[model samples]
Target: MQLLILLQLTIYFALVLSIRPRQCPKGLNDANTPRCVAMDGISDVEKNECRSAKHCCIGRNGYCYALPRKVVPTIDPDKTNEEMLSDAKDIMRSIKGGARFLNIGPFPSALLPYGGEDPYPGFPRLPAFVCHKRPRFPDNCDMEDKKALRYTRNPPLNIPYCIRIPCDPDLPELDESRTKCREMPGCFFDVQLRDYRKKFGHSVMAGVPVCQLAIRNKVFLEEARKVKDKTGEWTPYLNECLLDTFDEIIRTNHEGCKTLEMLEYFKHKPKIAGWKGIKEYDCYLIAGCWMTKKCYYPVDVNNVTVSASPTEHDDKIPSALYYGRPPCQKFDDKNAKSAIESYHSCLVSGCKLDKHAQNSYYNYLFDFGKSMDPSDHWVFWRLVESGKYGAHNLDEYNLLPKHDVTVTPFSLVFNYPAKPGESNLIDELLRPGSSSLLDMIKTGSGLQVPPAHQNIRDRFLEDLQGIQTPCSTTFTSFGARPCGPPRYKPTGVPNHCPYRPIEDKDLKPLRGSFEGCCDITLCYHPKEEIPNARSGAATYYSTWSYWTECSATCGKGNKKRWRRCIGMDQSQCTGRTTENESCEIVPCSSWNKWSRWSKCSLTCNSGVSTRTRTCKPIGGFCPGPDEEIESCNSEKCKIDRLFGPWSEWKGSCNPCGKSIYRSRECEATTCNDDDLYEIQQCPTGCGTWSSWSPFGPCTWDFFFRTCQKTRTRVCNGKNGRPTECQGNSVDVAYCIC
Candidate 1:
């Protein structure tokens, strides 16, 4: 029984590993293409490269899939109409650009959201050139990259029109009919409207839902021809426009200070939009385009009312190195609170510190009322939660005012006297601003990574838990120098509260004790003095270690092993701590010879073929490519055109008013293989359904904690079917329990 259970566990884990999504290898990552929507404005030939017979798709590294139909936001059946609409409006307006209806055009001649023949110009006549290997978009790109692509520039706002069938992946067939889609009721996905949105809207909208933009674009281009940012002249552009544009600029173009900040001043403001807003790409041509520009909106007396508010900081800000003050200090007369608030805002907004902020922070020891208790002074507690004052990182931060402390990168700072015995006594340490050496060790992590530990998990285990740094708070680390009497009060335990510093016996009384304070977190020191053994039991403090891999794999190699003495500080385990030995393995750099040629790609007049070889040691590099052309039935036969067979008319219909298209390629001797397309209308009839199939496996519905099953049948493809179905095929079954 136990054996069976272990076998089941192994099988389950194997299945889990096998289910990983199929994807192109890492080498092809850089070759990945942009979204299919990006192809909207390209010439017809490019569009053809992106389209399936009845759908659109992007070419990925090694695969492709039709673009998903834009998913609409729908309310729950439990919600009221007003509740749903009100909620949707808030969501739409909150998006970066806000929901927009760009009604651009009297449209420059016959141009439209989809261009004419050119939009699909280079499309091949081959009916089998369809791309539907997967049911979803390729998940080959990094998620961050995919997300950023959606918020990028809108495609060319117009392309030519062409008839297409719905290729919704959920529907099981690409050529599914409109009447069948209408079965669910309420705003059937209008493919024409969807196409218009792709052409008119940004490739992927950040905040707006699909349904909202589709309507706005269709309404304007189909009737009127004008565009506005916020829909009215009186409202003026909100400051949000500048902020959103700034964010977008940083994401899409990470050049200095970001060009989009300056672009926002014009794109959102009519006066500037006339020229500066032509295109984001055009901004590059103008010199110093990223220079910051603040906007001053037009004032109108009729719509404005003057009111007094708290004063905004009016100090002159230098373009370079001017920083803001820190929070939780200063309580003088006149806006002293505001200074703290301003510094707090700087922290919240992630701005740097200025001299004024530093000066305000200098009042850390300022007297707060009559209470000596730190808690009573609520003003001092005015903090940016999750962080404290001073540099959050060792690589950054200013020296404390009038202090001898010097912080180094990735380590703590400790200051002690130049001589061992001359180190600052604990009485002097009590004085403010003294840098104590007995306070920088990381006890938790030091113990985590033992001298014996060679595995990857020791120090890593502590970091993965997210401990705060500036090790004093974390480890309460402290050290006392020289073979002197214990400083402060001696404790029973080596490291404990009101901590008594232990003497560093390793430091001889040479030229008096050179006293120092420092953190030895990951790095340890030599062992302190150990008592001379009276009876010679030897203690057995260290152990032997296994040898490591050889330094070299071919001809000559040497391997070594070592043990650390953990008794008394970091030394004193007797004998030599390390040993070395020599060993070698055979060379693995040779490659195998080439193999025989395989079959050719085609059996025609001439078809290309190839053979391959390998490197002896797997994964070693070997580069070679040679070609051979096989010839068969090479005799030329004169003919105008010899047509290949017609394409299938699957998932197509005439019952609900739609045409099925088929094509044949010309394959004649010494002739072009150009395609000739044929369109056919099937006999009209209301679709019929087949009998329901046996129920599928019962699966737990996690949300409801109940077992349920499903059964489905096709419309035109299943038995008893006459034409395409007008209703959904799949149905759910209640659990028998």
Candidate 2:
């Protein structure tokens, strides 16, 4: 019933909770309501009002206004328009005067809300407010105070303050006392105000754009031209002249209208001159004119021929007149022939007289008279007459004569004649007896000879049968063969000393034995003989029979000599035995096998001498059929067959199949009929099993069993066994002990 009630209560509560509406703050249910409603509304109102008013709150206090519209002066109840304009003019003057102290331009009068009239009438105005004086002490006022009274306050006199006032947009806004002037009608004045402010503000405040800079480059050029013209003789003026000439040339040469423009065209052209002197200026000028098509040839100032000639007294004679000339007339009109005759006479008497005499008189007249024909001579004389023999004429005598003399008869010619007694007249007068004389000279008669020649009788000649011959012959032979001795004969051998003199001893009488000696012989023999007979035989054998035998047998048998066997006895070759035997026999077959048979053998002995073998049970005892056993020498042991109950040997042995078993022996005893004893086998093999004897005669019994104890025995229980003992000694119960 409670659960049901609880269920009903839960159902009711869930239904009620489901019907409940989600709660929210008041006035926030509408989706459009802004998260910061009040703050957003206030900000929108502030923006709209501020934008429309063109004003902003001044730091928790007053408002700042935009620059105002300029108010034109108008007539009022108490003031005339002229009076108001005058007052505004005065105010501008006063403001300008005060701005001087701040080094700023006068504030634009348009920024003022009321032109010449005070906004607040009858108020005691400070000098700064009434006159728009610059601020003097900014430290004395807060920013709001300073802004509220900006036009009235004397701002700290500084460059920045001055700049700020002129450039201050807020200043105009403050004059209007509203920000709405941003859309006002008269705002064009603000732009003018801004521009004026920019230009004049920089000038007064920062000392920049002070005034428009005046450029007068043309003025400088005009001045320079004037100076140049003033110093006309200076180098600079000369250079100007050259430049101007060049400029004019270019201007004129350019194809354009002949006006200032053309002049300007020529002004830029370069000037060229030939010489660097005063003449250069003239050249440039001329070139300039030529380029401008206004040129003419220069006037030739230095043009005239200079005449030079000799006077009558200094006239020279013609060379032909000095060499050869026709005779001169005494005065063939000295006036008419003065020029010709003066030269002719001077040349005839000048340096040519000796030359004319040698060539005309001696050379052609006498020395070579008729050798050269008369016509040729006449031609030569004509050449002389024409002064062809003048000193400068080298071709006149190219082939001249050379004189030569010779005597006719066979007479002794002497450069100087001999003395009267020096002549040999007798010899000169002798006549020949015959055209070929010979014998008369042998009679030795009428022969004229000198005293030195009288002793030479052998040279005297005799005439015999009209032939002349010497009485005694004195022969003088050269390059002739000498007479040898009578017995000497040539042996058909050359002379040993061909150049030696022939002596008397080298010649001898002839002998008959040498009549036909034509042949000769030569012989040679040894000086000693052998001492031993065997040595003699060996010698004879080597020299005669052995060599002969060798030459005849071995030499003839083969071209090569026989090779003597090394280390063999030579006497063996001479042995007398029919059975053939070698001096040192060489076996036909190899002896390697026999040699190896005689050598000792080599073999290795056993390292270890003896080895023993034995056997033992593999696991200390012989096992049953289910027990494991192993061979002693095998890598893995074997097991015997198992021989125990299932409880005693629960697990099978290894592959050998051996298991352990328990055994017991009974003691001699008498049994009581009423007493009973249970026997059990021990789990392991039994060893010296004993128990206490209560009576005199002890009874021993045997049964198949296992030893067991029944007390709290603690053992490792994971395998279902006791972990340990609790009592001192537990009673043993035999099951299969």
Best by TM-score: 1
- The lowest-lDDT stretch of 10 consecutive residues in candidate 1 is 528-537
Which stretch of 10 consecutive residues in model 2 shows the poorest summed lDDT? 532-541
Can you write out model 1's per-residue Cα lDDT over 1-737, one digit (the tens) per residue?
22322332233222222211223222322212222222222112233433321233323422332333222223232345566446545544432321111111111112211322223345232122222222111122233434334322221111101101122324532123334432221112334333433454432211111221111112212211221222322101111121222222322322322433332342211011102112333222111122234211121223221111111243443211121111111223244344444333232221233433433432321322112232222222222111222212212223322232222222222222222234332234334563332231222111212212222222333331222232221122222111111222212211311111223344221111111111111111111100100001011222234466678865478988665432112322346778889877645445476566666443443433566666656533344433334454454433644654565665466345466777655556443434557677666556667787887876766543434577898666334545666756876543433
Off by over 4 Å in 2: 1-360, 371-421, 424-737
Give per-model TM-scores.
0.16, 0.08
What digit string (tens of lDDT, one per residue) describes model 2 on residues 414-519?
1112233543422322444422111212331223333332222222221111122111111112111111113322232322211111123333321111111111
Task: Specify the highest-lDDT model's number.
Answer: 1
What is the lDDT of every predicted structure here? 0.30, 0.23
Q: Candidate 1 regions off by >4 Å? A: 1-563, 568-604, 610-737
